[model samples]
Target: MRTLILALSALALAGSAAFADPIADRQAIMKANGKAVGAIAPMVKGEKPFDAAVVLDALKTLSEDAQKIDVAALFPEGTDKGDTEASPKIWEDMAGFQAKVEKFRADTAAAVAAAPADLDALKVEFGKVAANCGGCHETFRIKKS
Candidate 1:
């Protein structure tokens, strides 16, 4: 009974530890966002045939991933020092950081609503949505060596 109790306690601790790492969780969310962008970028660039369904799917993925970013919870203080590329400016000006996140969400939502079915429309909407990525990264991401 003692051994069983100790094993169960260890399992609980391990589970909590996995969920407690906000840095890892945020990184995963960002990676997913990047992948969604990749999926539609070629279509916008004319490298791949424009597929309305693919564009909508990618836009939805971006919208969902953007919504997952609970800024305060994911970027809580003390998470700054790790394998993270988040800028210190994020903590110093959380409001700005959150605004950028909101902009990204709004842009993604707009892209979805536009439902770009042609290369021309995809270019326009995708440009708006992708700009949020560059703008946010400029202000809220550290340049890695």
Candidate 2:
């Protein structure tokens, strides 16, 4: 089941580039999100501790990788396709979109930097960091459930 999820997630990220322009940047961000989530799935499922150490380490790697994705570059004119659900508002509201992405990066960094030694406490804090994801997606990206 885990393998299936990972494979499907990878396919989604991998296939995302084929959907539109600025392929490199969108692909990078999706790939980074995939990698970050992959590293944390065990913890999320309770197979592992809500380990701050693990979360911190994963975010550290993810944060650096995420820097490669340029929000502006990824949404240039003519990038959209039939399959692309990215809202037209992304281009129209460029500044707002960029702010969300930047906040995600900063919040992830903050979560990692402040990761607690206690695992349970870590879980609570980590949730805040993870929420940054939906924060951006809610306004900018189109994803079904």
Candidate 3:
């Protein structure tokens, strides 16, 4: 009974960590991404310090990195701690998720291709593309404080 109890405790701890992995990754990505994006606003007004092509290049890199995430890997077996902001319905409604993912992929790619030679051109496209992130977060992600 003591051995069985020990095993059960170990299992619970391991299980919780698996569930928390995505939350940890999400936090880390947001930290990096927030800082990266913050650099754009100021550059959007200046000429010497600003380079829309470079910004678009960075966006391409970010989009590539985003694709590396295997979202299903975040889900654990036999879990009950339901704190994940990602809707369980995401798995059930794969078509919608896939469409959103593809849209993000295309939008990011197009924005990069369409990088404006001047700040005026870049700012318009930049804000439009950036809005996609919030839409996904609102629908699929849990609010983080």
Candidate 4:
């Protein structure tokens, strides 16, 4: 019984540790979002042939990634000091930052719903999602040299 208790306690701590660093958590989610964009960017640019299934899958990934972000929890106070590219403007203008996040979520969700099958349709939907990422990065991310 004691051994089982210890094992369970260790599992709980390990699970909690995964969420201990909000910066890392948010960064991981953003990286996943980037990868989703990368997967579809070539088709959008006409460099690769449009595959409807791949486009739809990528959009779904973006939508799921956006849903994982919890702005208030991830951008909490004191997190701005870490090894993060998050700009101070995030904490200062949290409302604007949150608005951008919301826009991203909404845009990605719409893109997934539209499931653009043709290259032209993919271009339009992908453009909206990319714009949200760019706009938020411009205002809320600190560019690293």
Better of 3 and 4 by TM-score: 4
TM-score for all predictions? 0.86, 0.68, 0.61, 0.88
Question: Cα lDDT of model 4 overall?
Answer: 0.92
What's the C-alpha lDDT at position 70 in model 1? 94
Please write out the lDDT profile of model 3 over residues 1-145, one tens digit for every residue: 9999999999999998766766556556655656556666567656348776667766765466456445555433322145545665566666676666677677767766776677777777667656777777666666646
Of 2 and 4, which scores higher on lDDT? 4
List the pairs of residues colliding in candidate 1.
none
Question: What is the C-alpha lDDT profile of model 4 across 1-145, one tens digit per residue?
Answer: 9999999999999999766889988999989988899999999888899999989998999999899889887999999996999999999999999899899999999999998979999999999999999999999999878
Better of 1 and 4 by lDDT: 4
Clashing pairs in 4: none
Instruction: Please report the TM-score between candidate 4 and the true structure.
Output: 0.88
Error of 2 at 84 (Å): 3.9
lDDT (Cα atoms) of all candidates against the true structure: 0.91, 0.70, 0.64, 0.92
CA-only RMSD, every prediction? 3.9, 11.0, 7.8, 2.7
lDDT of 1 at 31: 94
- Cα deviation at 55, candidate 4, in Å, is 0.9
40-91 in candidate 1: lDDT tens per residue?
A: 9887676899888888999999999989999988999989898999999999
